[model samples]
Target chain A: MRLADNYEKNGDLIVTTLYDYARRIANQVTVVKDQGRDWDQLIDDLVTSKYFGYPLMFLLLGVVFWITIVGANCPSQLLSDLFFWFEGQLTFVFQLVQAPEWLYGLLVLGVYRGLSWVVSVMLPPMAIFFPLFTLLEDLGYLPRVAFNLDHLFKRSGAHGKMSLTMSMGFGCNAAGVIAARIIESPRERLIAILTNNFVPCNGRFPGLIAMSSMFMAVGISMASSSLVSALVVASIVITGIMITLAISWLLSRTLLKGESSSFTLELPPYRKPQVITVLIRSFFDRTIFVLWRAVKVAAPAGALIWFLANITVGEYSFIAYLADFLDPLGRIMGLDGVILLAFILGLPANEIVIPIMVMTYLSEGAMIELDSLSAFRQLLLDQGWTWLTALNFMLFSLLHFPCGTTLLTIKKETGSKKWTILAAVLPTIVGIIVCTVIAWIVG
Target chain B: MLMIISLDQLPVGESGIVTVIDAHGLTRRRLLDLGLVPGTVVKTIRKSPAGDPIAYLIRGSIVALRVNDSKQISIKPFSEVAINE
Candidate 1:
């Protein structure tokens, strides 16, 4: 009988017998090295231990987020100041050249500000995060991460490799979707691609951080406030992980029904991470690439937002009308129309969501940044945002649709528009349901 | 007499020689690629918390196999002193 037919006929017995036969000969011929208790074994004992594995994973995740949040602040401020200065110079030149009001608004207020915001806000985190992540990958910790999570994934009827891709989603969901290619099973890969959006990416960090600071850290000291913010974000991340597992299990049972494919993951030896090489690779490959994509989508969206906010239909601008139209629905979900409109308009890039919200609130001709977290909190309050609204908003943001680029990435990865549409629709439906439930309870 | 036991039934820290991998298609190919071919020795390393998937050391690498998949492969048990060279 042929191998394929034999597999169909005898099921698993043939494969096991073959391996058993191979073992018999190998024992007879080969003199295997008995490196009884190597360093790799020692480390694996702790990392893959049933007890400590998961706690260590969560601890490491918290550390990474803390470092990214604290480390990005100074550089983010410096970049923001520099970019705003450059924006001022550009506006002055445009005025000196007597550029038309519309052209000045479109080019300076819209495109320039959009690009600058994305770069200043996004670049530092990616610069910090990607290298740190790559260092883990280089040190062989990531696979052990896979090793540790393997059983949970297996229990969910999903591939063990989903753990790695989910971690990749932290930097960028588009990259995470692309990283799903590492999984050989097409079914599990689809599951990974569809669920990658649950984990908020670097682009969503500003909004998450803003909300965390304004609401979560109400009375904490400045030193511990950032720490509190980090913890809030970490818990949200944990929530995202729980959701991912739940969704993965759901998908496995319903849409992508098949036994999870088994594969051997060779845990590579831990080595000294080549710092210079990793830095250059991460800087060029991850930081620049993700920043460029965000900037590309953000600039056009920025121009559109500026036009909508500036062009008045009688007294209220188009954006105002949009917010008004969305207000009733948004209220049902414990958010204002302006907040909903910002999320809708910020579909191109998540990094712009808070800025769009700030612009909508200020009703300024351009997106504006508050000088401090207190001002941001006051602004949200003036918009009638309660604690419930903040909680639901964060949950909604965490569960909503992926940005345009990520949807495109899903389409390309899945090669089926049906799956891509499902990817876009699934989380959005969940987000609405979750927000509504929360809102109803709070009310 | 040839004493055969399923790989999943093999106790932790005990080594066995693979005898029969009764699986097919991609799964069968995967097992072979992971050096689970006949004549190779595998030792059950550890189990996760929930304990369905067990880790095994095969060809010097730790490969995790769920009980469902691992149970299909049969192995011949060997004493540790037999292979101590």
Candidate 2:
């Protein structure tokens, strides 16, 4: 063991010597052929060039998000229609069998409605976004994103690879926390894990996209509304990234103080991404995995929400009392009590926040499917929602604590109660501060 | 005598032969494992827009090294070395 330790002490020298010998033998034995066109280097030069690099990165990212928003709408509508139609059939059967009122309400109206809302609203975006993102990863573009953004990250005293993990956060914060494994430094990894929630994941994206589109539709033309909303969402993403850097900087200076570790990132040669493999892998791996988790959480949450909405005390249901209790705090944050309740209940999965809000607003035991965005907007308006409310809700969604799955992942990854708790607390504090400040100014 | 400079000081599109690596412990080992030994040819490819970590062609692969790491690697310009030869 001592001899092995001694060898390990001089491991670098030994590896250098071995490489020297291998190079010498290979140089003598082999003839090298020069490729006429070095396409890889050419593309790298263009993409990483000073003038074009940042623009190209933002443009590509914007295009992906734009496609996701536009492409997801039709499928989301179709799935919603099909699921509600199925819900109608189930209700018919329940009536035909003369099932107990409470049983039918809980099973079909509550649990089934929540599950269907989650699936229809959440699936199409994930299905579209993950494959597009995976295609970029397969094409070796993600590392270049890290490469371009490394300087900013380094300035914030975090590893450059934090950029890659943040990209994963766009899909899911739990996945993002796991991807922090790429950062070898414990300090930076913790920073990445704690701040990953700043980026709104796929679960939150459906809500953000919906709200932002509505926010833009007021004054914008139909032709430009989608584009404007895409830009709005993009800016929110940028804001989240800014918050990530700010918090990373704050952590390094205070709680997790350390010098940024040295890292050598290889800019792998871009490859022709295999389309078939990209689709299948992204579908089964990311879309299905995340959907399953959301579905699992949504059912229990649905039942709980139904119970809250159905079981009344005096004149109001439990949900109304809870919302009334939270009203002052929510009002301070430029949101209503129901919105706050939705966020609290959304702890399990962000995908169900909107549905919960809808269920509570109607004060019904079950969730109702909104026929259109205009009708949705009208409902919110009737409930005293304003432009500021929508804006704060979007901002809150972007800045708030990660969902329950992410907290579990952080605990498992850090294995420390303090850091896991900080991971949850840090972002929530930031969200509260931001929302309160916005409401104070606007109110 | 050829003037030796740190790798980060080498201009983009310039080629240099490494002369010494002034790093230790895991950092030193990592640099060596990446083929940054004495006499290896390294070329600066480009700079990221924010311009701290620079990409270089090392051992036929493009690798990005932060200024902190690259500044520790000393190199002699290949143009000057060829003239000396």
Candidate 3:
């Protein structure tokens, strides 16, 4: 210890010295082989080039989202059909046993239907999206994405790697919050965590896609409607990214004031993505995990929603009373009371927000699955939805508070109650402010 | 004569020998740990779309550094004549 103290070298000097020795040893022992062509450098040259980089990134993102939206439709329809068929069997079994109506309502209508709705609606897209995203990650493109978008993040006074975390947010916000650990600096990591909710996760994507498709349906060709909807969803994602940057800038300058930390991102060589491995890994690790959480939350939420729609007050159901109480505030945000109530009740899991709203609107004990986007749009239109309301709903969904799982993740990650609450409040406030302004403007 | 310039100023596709890393604390340590020590040959590979952070080849690995951080690294460019020699 005394000898080390006498040497008095700083950490940087020690690392430099050690690397110097290692480099010298490697130079002496290793034989050089000229591979002639460097594929990695060639790829990086194009990928990280100033002109092609941003366009390639956006094109890749658009293609992935387009593929996910188009590909999941058939499987989602099939899954819904299978589940509802099972529901029929369940109904038969209930009648055979002569179960009470309340028991039937709670079990077959409430819990089982809710679980099926989540699985059928959420599973197909998630199963498709996660594997595609994981393929990019496995191919080492994500770090290059961070590399490409670092300048924007740096301008926001946040670490560059926040881009990586934000991309993870597209999968799930809880996972995104966990991904913030890659940002070594505490202040910037918090910024990443707080701003992650601005990006709509997979849970909210179904709603956004449906709304965009429904909105695009009018005055557009059938073939191009999906393409336009994908573009609309992409634009919503861009809006979310802008909000993320703006909020990150606000937090860094105001609450979490600090200079942005230095980070060195190693752009790894792209490898041949293992197709089967990526499929299986993303299936179990992300899709199944998220589906399980959504199902767990959706079951009880379904039961509660069923009760709310069934239990009568004076003239209306309990949910109607709650919606009436929130109608004024919801109107200010260009949404009805039931919409706001759905958001609140759907806090446990975003996958059920639309289902809850539909159940309330129908005033039915069970959440019903519509056969087509037009049917869903017809229901919303019957409820007096305008373009303004649809826009504001998408905006609100994009900017609202993180779900319960994400809040818990923020709490566990930051290990501070203050930050966790701030994480929840900051976005919710932004969401409310944005929604209200848009509503007033449209009005 | 060799010209000394900040790493951030080295044009893409140019090679230079690192002279000094004028950063402090963790940043400096990270740069050194990535084998950016003096006398190491570094190549400016590509710039991001925004042209602020640039990728560099150092010790056979590609590492990206933002302009603010990369400016702290000083290097001596190898002249065309020197490369030919």
Best by lDDT: 2
Per-model TM against the reference? 0.86, 0.93, 0.92
The better-scoring model by TM-score among 1 and 3 is 3
Off by over 4 Å in 3: A1-17, A24-38, A364-369, B80-85
Q: Which model, 1 or 2, shows the larger DockQ?
A: 2
Error of 1 at A56 (Å): 1.4
lDDT tens per residue, model 2, A96-210: 9999999997887678877887788778878898999899999999888888889889988998888889988888899999999988888899889999999889888888888
- CA lDDT scores, all candidates in order: 0.80, 0.85, 0.84
lDDT for model 3 comes to: 0.84
Q: Locate the minimum summed-lDDT window of 10 residues in model 3 chain A.
A: A364-373
lDDT of 3 by residue, A159-220 (tens): 88888888888888999999999988888999998899988898898788778767754687
Question: Which candidate leads in TM-score?
Answer: 2
| Real interface contacts reproduced by model 1, as a fraction | 0.45
* lDDT-superior candidate, 1 or 2: 2
Clashes of each: 26, 0, 0
Candidate closer to the true structure by lDDT (higher is better), 2 or 3: 2
Model 1 scores a C-alpha lDDT of: 0.80
Q: Please give the ranking of all candidate structures by DockQ, highest first, separated by commas.
A: 2, 3, 1
Residue A422 accuracy (lDDT) in model 2: 87
TM-score of chain A of 1: 0.85
Where model 1 places Cα greater than 4 Å from the true spot, the runs are A1-37, A90-103, A179-186, A364-369, A372-378, B1-3, B80-85
- The best candidate by DockQ is 2
